[model samples]
Target: MATVLGSVRAFFAQSAYSIDQENPGDVVARERLLDRAMGEARFRNSSEKLRRGRVPADGLALVARDPDGYVIGTVRLWNVEAGVDASGNAVPALLLGPLAVDPEHEGKGIGSALMRAAVTEAATRGHGAVLLVGDAPYYERFGFFADKAKHLVMPGPSERDRFLALELKQGWLGGAAGVLVPSGRRFGRAGLRKAA
Candidate 1:
């Protein structure tokens, strides 16, 4: 009986949180969590230039929820052209950013979990590469390296070293060059037009 009880406790403890697709209802909460984790500086980030007025790639936005079902983490990927290749053909890639976890939930693996989920899903969806501007030490473990993105540049000013990438398919980014541009769907202004 004690063994069975211990198993149940372990299961519950491990299940204290869950990762899932971000639903419509999670937007506000996700935004709040991002604000808390990243503060106002997140808006001025160079990556925002590519992400602004754009929607995340289909089904690439994700959220982490705590035991009480509150959103504690968020990560999203946007489609971007990794510049034209040697043959001048546009090389497509995904830009990851604003990966934020609630301040209170720091050190609980929520950010890492969200990252792994996002990258795995992007690969499963057949994306060729993933890029982001982040701390080297934290992202290096996920195969994101500066050398891979050395030839590429963000739309706005960004530290060279902070830009990193992981090619989902080997050599997917090889020969890719030029400024990254937004290739994802934009938030249509139809609603705004109607409001006007």
Candidate 2:
């Protein structure tokens, strides 16, 4: 009876250890995860559109990795500016999007972690705001909203509700309003620099 109880305790201890080893704190480590998560469909579609001499290379790319070192999610930002706002300020903003999480890991907080990291980085780099086209409910949790309606617009048609922005600093979008051009010159030298 004593031996059986000891063995049971050992089994339980090993199980706990295994679980701990499997769930290390989420971290962003590399760009490969973004490439892999983008996959062919994502690459051919959204990525291709953004990469077409438009998106800036200087923008940021981030990923969330699990304890096993597997990339579970990703987000990217691009250099952009908004038209003059009510205050007559030319608001330079960052376009945020293409946030994706592994299907198997969708509900595990990986997406949120990636978003938090990107937002923090953008703020640290002195960006005014981060914009995106996504669900209001999901993004709202991260302080994204439609407050830029008066001064923000996308180059192509986009649902008004889906268009959103988050200010990293107070009055970041003051006096800015206009079409959001892809960070590059639609593919010129500046564009090349952005895509680099």
Candidate 3:
């Protein structure tokens, strides 16, 4: 079903926009887009607990740009420990969040494009699984499901049914259980100063 929907989306997706790796120059525009799409409530999301002061996984921060070169969409993935397996070994996973597309571009498929790009990049980087707290109806089309994520938990409050996961490698999430913890590189003072 996911595959079929993916093909259908691909068939109708517009080509006027481009998906690209997020760069320093895109930071401002991306943040503005996110603010408009999610408002102040975005900062209160459960995923923000894992992402605050942490850099996204290497090469996993992405943006969708319009033909005019403006950022129209954004999505980022952060490294997280999806708890421990039954035997106690740490289970590494990527947490995807704040996927937002500009309101003007909402129906252009930019969000879906950014989603595919980020997930594809994670898979290419050999990530085991990707977790997200999002609407199941929307994200499930990308293979994210609650079944595998049932045993995993995030730091803050999140609807159990809304927490979802997609295993890039079959069985990578098998036996996984525990609270998600940030495992990505910290946003250091230097980076903070630069952003400032």
Candidate 4:
């Protein structure tokens, strides 16, 4: 049987597309596509503010490639301490953002494929929740909802309605109320090794 990613690609008639762990060699194309997908002003967004100068979470960055090996879509999850739990210890969560598809690839299921792969990979790696600042309508389908993040705060200004969260592990958001702070861990060029 074909994989779910393949199913999504088939749904969008994108059989030549594939999502894979990001290789450092794709950085330049990723950056160019990001610039085109999000534009230069994207730097001012709240999510960008949080990720500034920090590396994405270990093994959480992924890219969607076309048949020719070009990076056509990208989605990354960064490590963030959502807040304290009932025990007063930091609750680790993933911050998903910059989910971009190349302009030429828009209208295809590339973006959805990237989101599905990123979240699935994150959960498989033992993360409990994912948070993001984005369109409620677009992300809600992926289980992102303002209510899920009602108790948390971003590091900078953001539209209250657009900030959302999804709990891969049930109850991960309950009492997860606090500032979203970066985990401060460095991600090297090698990207973290995938979980065996």
Candidate 5:
């Protein structure tokens, strides 16, 4: 019975792929694939901005690997805080960006698999909402939207249409407003404090 069930599952697996949390040593291949994928995606500027931040130390990265152990896609999340609200409350939020897939592997469901793994891991880790500057149509499929606009601002100039947010948990935004900034201990003790 177990053998039969396993065979049945494999038959309907759709694609023979696996999504997992990226290990530290996978950085080199991940970067190569990311560079290739971003180049193909025509998001050179966005890729450059992400590279300058040293995202690995600040956020979690998940990758989709083929059976041969090659990374074909990747997604990342960073710790960031909202700018400031009228009442002076600093809203804390997560920054999601740099989602890329190997050009040759696009439309193979790798990007979607990476996103699902990242979001699940983030929710389990007790994160708030995730804010990003991306396409509305593509991101909306993952439950991301502009509902948090009043409580969100990007670090740099971003088109209003592209900026979006998604609640990882219920009411994660809580109507808070502020500019997004890096939230990491290395930034200094003063910066380590969470915003109200």
Candidate 6:
């Protein structure tokens, strides 16, 4: 199903906008797009607990630009410990969230393009899994599921059914069980250069 959707998305992507690594100048636009898509409620979501003070994972922050050189979409993935409480194993997983598209650009496939980039990049860099709090109807098409994530928990309150996980490698979340936490390296924008 995921593959089928990916192909369908690809078919529509023939004339897709350009996706690139987000730069310093892209922050404001990214923030606006996020606000428009999720409103202030986004800052209070469970995933924000992990991303609060930490920087986005290296090579995982991206923006989609329109033909006019405008940033129309944004998505970022952060680092977190998959089993911070129960096992204290320090197992790493990328947390994807705040994936937003301009209101007028919603049906253009910009959001899914960013998702594909995020998951593919994480796997290429050897990360195990990707986690997020989003609608199953939307995210499941990207291969994220609650079945594997049922064994894990989030730091703050989150709708159990909305917490989803996708293993980049086969069985990446097989033994992962515990609370997700801000387990990634400490890095703000200034410290981003230090992350691998």
lDDT of residue 1 for candidate 6:
11
Instruction: Write model 4 residue lDDT over 151-170, tens digit each, in one string.
Output: 89988889999999999999
Q: Which candidate is the best by lDDT?
A: 3
lDDT of 5 by residue, 1-196 (tens): 1122233235425566666556666678777986786654445443234334334323356676776777777777766665654567666666776788889888877777667666666676677777778889998998888876655666556787788888887776766676667763343333323210
lDDT of 2 at 7: 37
* Per-residue error (Å), model 3, residue 46: 1.1
Task: Score candidate 2 by TM-score against the native.
Answer: 0.67
Write model 6 residue lDDT over 40-153, tens digit each, in one string: 998887888888878788777878887666889988889888884345567788899878999989997889888987787777778889999989999999999999798889
Which regions of candidate 5 fall more than 4 Å away from where they truly are?
1-14, 40-59, 85-87, 185-196
Error of 2 at 2 (Å): 56
Mind giving the per-residue lDDT tens digits that candidate 1 earns over 89-140?
9999999988999999889877887788888888878899999999999999
TM-score for every candidate vs. truth?
0.89, 0.67, 0.89, 0.88, 0.76, 0.87
Cα lDDT computed for each candidate against the true fold:
0.84, 0.61, 0.85, 0.83, 0.64, 0.80
Q: List the residue pairs that clash in candidate 6.
A: none
Displacement of the residue 70 alpha carbon in candidate 5, Å: 0.7
Candidate 2 lDDT, 1-196, residue by residue in tens = 1122233234334331111111113223323444555555555443235445564324355555555555566666777756666766566777886887777666766677667767776676677788888889999999999876556777665778888888888877766787775553465655544443
For every model in order, what is the number of clashing pairs?
Answer: 0, 11, 0, 0, 5, 0
The regions of model 4 sitting more than 4 angstroms off are 1-14, 187-196
Which residue runs does candidate 2 get wrong by more than 4 Å? Answer: 1-51, 54-59, 85-90, 184-196
**Whole-model lDDT, model 4:** 0.83
